[model samples]
Target chain A: MKISGAQGIIECLLEQGVDTVFGYPGGRILPLYDAIYEGKIRHILTVHEQGAIHAADGYARASGKVGVCIATSGPGATNLVTGLANAYLDSVPLVVITGQVSTDLIGADAFQEVDITGITMPITKHNFLVKDVATLPEIMRFAFRIASSGRPGPVLIDVPSDIQLDVFNFTQEEEQEKNKPRFQWELSQLGSSLIDRAAAVLETAKQPVMIVGGGVVSSGAYEQVVALAEKMNAPVVSTLMGLGSFSSEHPLFLGLTGMHGHKRANLAVHGADVVIAIGSRFNDRVTGNKFKYAEGKTLIHIDVDPAELDKNVSTHIPLAGDVKQLVTTLNERIKPFNPSPWWKVIWEWKQEFAVKPDGNDLSATWMLKQVAERTKGKPFIFATDVGQHQMWAAQNLHIETPRSWITSGGLGTMGFGLPAAIGAQIAMPTKRVIAIVGDGGMKMTGCELFTAASQGLPLITIIVDNSSLGMVRQLQQLFYKQRYSESLLPVPMDFVCFAKAFGIEGTLTTTQEEFLAAFSAAIESNCPRVIIVKIPTEQLVTPMLKPNSPLDTFMDI
Target chain B: MGHHTISILVLNQSGVLVRVAGMFSRRGFNIESLAVGTTHVPEYSRITAVMQGSDAIVAQVVKQLEKLVEVRAVEILPVNTAVVRDMAMIKVKAAQNKKLEVLQLAETFGAKVVDISNETLMVEITSGKTNTDALIDALSSYGILEMIRTGVVGLQRGDCSIYEKEKCEISALFDTAQVEA
Candidate 1:
């Protein structure tokens, strides 16, 4: 069983059920590359380390398993930070392995030596630097456990050059049996008693509304949420991160509720007699004008993270546990209420606040709706970068399952989509994967297209090009008196040419006919493809309420 | 303000001392002194830092420390009957100085001058906060120039270390139960 550290890595990955890894080989990681060559694990050589990490992230989101990425130390390791942070914010499970300098020369500032473990600590759930060859198997097991457990996140393991060259006997059974921390959802210990109290509140309330967040998605509790909502006969509003938790087409579904949420969604929250919040930390953006948000409503908060309860809005009842379990238990105890009257009132508001884009026949919003339709009922993963396109995708995409929509919510990290798409496609090869990105965001990590092409991941990327930072430009145009400063990127590179250079099929569309053709063609392609849709620069995401403003006060141009 | 025990795991790399010390200085967290050393893993190190701040401020400091990429895990360990120790190596000018007074002071504080030259005396002191402070105050009058103190290393008075015993037991029990099942 004596195997080199590099061989042990491949063995450990295979043990963890990892079939492929995204990485680029360098002098420091030559041993690992050689081992990969000798082993059966597929290695997708990315053009850049950032692309590797993003591809891994996409894979994790798409597959619902921990994605793996590898890179040499120093610059290569630093490049993965953005993608790591993206996965961290979105709660995607990822395991990143980086090659380090020799143990003896670790502190000598040797070539390609970087303190990756230290640098990645804040961005990772947990990280380890393997100095001893014996610890490699244990560390890899521990990394996978930590990355995939609790709130899923990215974990980094740095293996020194000397350790990679060292020999070790790593028994598969021993490695598999390596003990690690387990985050269990004990009903009693997690304060499930509060659910009874919350049920009482839900039972008596005249108008009850539900606010769901990304935690529901992370916990795979979308069905539970839908069931609870239907049983309660309550309208469900979602945070941007909570997109696709409830069927947008469902009668009980209220559009996204936040700073950029629909006016009716905000109004519904404000007018509710009782608010049942599940798996969502009431972030500042979601609770605009915090003092007045859900005014006079009895707030029943349910979250796994204890710190999130009563952190922003005052809660009458708080339940701490996994959202899925809590909702299922609550569904059994609570009595169903008739919401036809309340639904009628909310539907009227929804109709009044409904947004219809003008002039631009095929706007980004329209394109998203079309994409959602074309993909059919099969679960297609959507990874989005931040900007107008991200919000549009969140508002438009119909997510029927958990982990179907992956986007940086808390950190709002740009350049997240392309890399995340790469990860998702790798993780779930059978499903269609799409990266919906704005022009600004696409340019930030557009290089990852080459990574996608090289892997033949069959990921389809749709870039909403408006020749500027559309979100900022809209804000400046609407609120800042049209003083667009440092928001427009002049000499914008041709996206089609960029994708073509990466040896990937590319298309640019300016009209509805062209857009449909381009999108249809990209989806049919065997390899990764990019489709750029030219959008009007003046287009803005409508029904926008100013930050910290009441739901009643909104500006729509 | 109450005493807070901050446990930090860091990369066992050089310049870590300077970076950590500088953080304390810049943040003005009156470092009641610190103790650092390599852990069981050579690549990883542990540093126990003691500071006095309000609960809110201490939590803020812990959050800030956690934000540092170099800092691995940071937890505010509860200090109830904990064994905390600080070691200081002080070099005092012996010639024409109060050598007997310094030695007497050191003796009273259970400190010893390990190395002595004709003109300089190297005193090593390991004690609690009060004793360390008293020795520093007494030695300052004798022209104490060079002093290197190994911040503060501490452990709770218990049967075993937290990570070693508690984590191992829990994980072992879980593993055994899984295997048996």
Candidate 2:
């Protein structure tokens, strides 16, 4: 039947199984907002467009479904760029629908007009500016398909105000999808010869270490990775993005590997004779000194995204396909083997660098440990911003489920945690979504607290107040002779009052007991709450490895 | 120098060219030459890009190009197995006294005199890199005034099309990859 462009968009969203969208409405998007007001789909009004997009990203990460968001033209569109970039780097699937100026006024310098398609061309997987109402349904379908398929990423569709005002029959546009060109290089499952070759590499390994990355989480290959790790009797190490792919409490897990990675995991990769890299593109942080990264290891790299195969570090054997499929095939083909001799060294390193919570006056790691202990055997998602607190959260939080750990690993975008927790909580309502944010990063997007609190989301923002950019300060102290330039926050910004101002209950905890009490109360409250924990300024991410250094060589802290 | 030519078959979409070209600059790979034209197929635009880089970097580019949604297929054309050519038009200031010499030089290089003026001769030539550059160098002696060259473009010199079922159809491999080991 006939429908307005706004209704057509809502129809497409429903067709694609989208139940909710996050966006900040504006004058240009009034038509779409009217449809949203009258439609069945839920729309969240975030205080900022950046918060909306990031929440969508977090929802996608937590729910394994394509997240949707919207914004008006110009500055509203521009505000979504950083979030789109973050989702792009993390490979999170999103369909961003932005309102645009009228067709006649597009380049006429009308109010709120911007070249969003041109601006987002480099960042989005693909984008389209809809000038014709006949193409609305088709463009919307294409947006979701492109965003969710292959290597998942964000796709933007700029709907002009006049186009949204136009009326068209959805059936007419449905026929156009049949003629759309199919991508030939859409990731095809590779020939088993490569799998055979990979098995041969595994067969000859004396000390094998399986390193998983974000690919595992994105591909939902958690069980297969666990099976392979168990079958081979190998220790599993994850990159920052791979945190939730395998259980943190699993016996075989060796924690994160790379710069600021666990010493056990780093040393394990360094000592490995054969490294099976699953889904992790060797990021620069992970492959510090690519020349010396895996010098003697027989590296087998597997990734769904073919471009990532040898983009960073050269691999001896490259398997390009879906991680879930490849890992399953590997599990079936490779015979169970024991690497206990190698595990002897691994266990030694694990014990030597084990995380022990001692006398804690709200140290980042110690606070996270208490949270982890209290929430043990329970479902929780720890979303973090970038910094020492992010590393601490990754190291200390017990994420037993896939998609439980949501952090901006690739982009390391600050102000990500709070908004991300908002998305994750909305996606997984029953689970506790904790925003483990730093003092520095929280200031970037703290307005998202309004979004969370107003929605009555039970997200806990555990803002670690170190009164400085602790990670940057540590870098300066180490290499710059302790010249703390502009790294420290100028004033003592009380996060508790900030939360209270947003109509959310909050508490300030200076010690472990107080923090634990407040945290327990927040958990029992079943509503949004903020707990500001005061961490000492000197506390830094341990075992910091200088860039371009081998993983095994860390500076003496 | 690790110079390679990549031929891409893409959906004739409005932004496909930008998407393909953007991938190169996005990855920091300098493009030596790039040419785009319609193909024999109705909905396909063929892009031939020449670049200088290590084999690994070029391979990475090819892989990245294939990931674009509008890209139908990407193949790295080997220099020996491909028929790469560049076309150029050179205007030389061969006044009345030197017009014959310029004409004779164009003839020797099998270049066509596409345009002529009272004081200049514009010669057009299509050839491989060496011959194309050599002809321009030969005309430079006659005081070349202006010149324009189409960047390199070509396909594999054989019966094999990029769309051959044996090459493009991924199902056979997909079937094998799907079977339980």
Candidate 3:
């Protein structure tokens, strides 16, 4: 049947099992909004384009589906940049649709026209400018496929207004068949690349350490990761993205390894002779100094994206394929080994440098532990913004479920929590979604509270208000001889009042008991709630790797 | 760090070159010379990019290039076992007196004098980089006014093609049955 291009977009979305999308419409995208109104799909109108994009990212990460968002030309398109970069870095699959000026006016710098495809080229997995309505269906299909495929990322489709008004015949069944995966492309052949030798290396090593990254969750290799760790008798360390890929409570699991990673985990990695890094890109945050990182260790790196194999550090054995498949094959080939002696050293280090709150004061660490304890045994999800609180949560939160832990790992994006939590709550209506934000992070995208309240999402936003940019201050104190210039928030606006303005109940907690009570109440509430947990000014993420040092290096505590 | 020629097969489409070029600049790899054109299969295009980098950087260049959705295949051809060509047109400020010497020098390099005027002689050469550079050098003393090169394009020797063997497999001797198309 012949249909308008906007309706064809709807048809293509339905063909791909997408029943909902998050977006903010504008003048150039009126036709798309009209089609959305007539279509059966649910369209979430966020307060801002940034909120819409982040919500889609959160939806994708939480629901394991391709997240969709839309925006108009110029400012609407540019506002989605941070979210695009965030999704790109963290490998979240998002289909972003932007309305562009008419084809005749594209290069004329027409009103509200911007070169969105050019701007998003470096950040997105792939992007397209719909030259005509004829390719709309295929472009939409490929956009989703590319976004949701190997090493998933965000793909943008910039359709001109004229194309949205154009007519096209889009049959869902025929079009779907015609648009089957365009490429039989494999990043690398999953064979004897590093399997046999890597398994042998793990089995024979006296001190072997396995480091898991976000790839574990993406590949659904959690169970295999557990099995492999047990079979090799190697202690497992989780990257920021690999938080919930393995059970935090597992005896072999040493939580979060990186700059702000657990002290014992860093020591374990530094002392290991063999490092089996699975599904990790080894970003700078994880490697203190690339030259000094694992200098003598034999590195076995497995990642679905081959470009990331040796991008940061050289890999002794680069196994480029799906992490789940590679780890499963490695699991089958390897034999169990006894690491009693390794465990002895790990145990001593664990006892010597366990991750715990230093004092009894109401700190970020103290607040995070209380939040984690209050939400225990409940169907819960924790989404965090980047800051001291994020690091504290990574260091403290005990997550056991894959996809349960969602945060901006690679981009370390601020203002990601509120909209992300709203999206997660929408994706997982039955589960409790909580947003953990620092004062600084909350200030960046705090306006998203309007979205949560308007949608009536049961998202609990916990603002760990340190009254300062705590991480920046901590850094200055370490390097600048305690010259905490400009890092302090001299004018502290009342976050509780701000939350109340958004039609959400707000509470201020200064003590541990008060925080627990507020947190528990928020958990029970069906509507959005914001709790401001005031922490000490100097709260820091300790065991931070100093410049030009190894992972085990740190400043004087 | 040395230069390596990487040949890529990508779907003939707009914005594909920008994607490849963007990845190069984003990853800090330097493109010494690049030539792009359609292949015999009209649906696909070939991009011959010569990049300067270390072995690891070149490995990343090839790996990163293959990640593009439009890119079908990539291979780094060995320097010795390949036939490379660079097409250049150099316009030299030749007086009526020096035209024959420039012509004779260009003839030595198998160059054609495509255009001639009393003020200048335009010499064109399609050969390896060495021959093209030599022809330009021989005309430089005659006051070469302008010059342009079509970068460098190459194909592996013997029976193997980029589609049949990647990384310019020197041992692709047995795959003689598969045609280049």
> Per-prediction TM-score, please?
0.81, 0.95, 0.95
Which residues of candidate 3, in runs, are more than 4 Å off? A174-190, A356-358, B165-181
The true-versus-predicted C-alpha distance at residue B80 of model 1, in Å, is 10
Prediction 3 TM-score vs. true: 0.95
> For candidate 2, lDDT tens digit of each residue in A76-130?
9999999999999999999999999989888898998889888898888878889
lDDT of 3 by residue, A239-358 (tens): 999888898889999888898899889889999999999888998888788888868899999888878888899988888766777788889988888788999999999988865555
Scored by CA lDDT, what does every candidate get? 0.79, 0.86, 0.86
DockQ-derived CAPRI band for the predicted complex in model 2: acceptable
- Cα error, residue A92 of model 3, in Å, equals 0.4
**Candidate 1 CAPRI assessment class:** incorrect
Better of 1 and 3 by lDDT: 3
- In model 3, how large is the Cα lDDT of residue A477? 87
| True-vs-predicted CA distance for residue A14, candidate 1, Å | 0.6
TM-score preference between candidates 1 and 2, better one: 2
RMSD of 1: 5.6
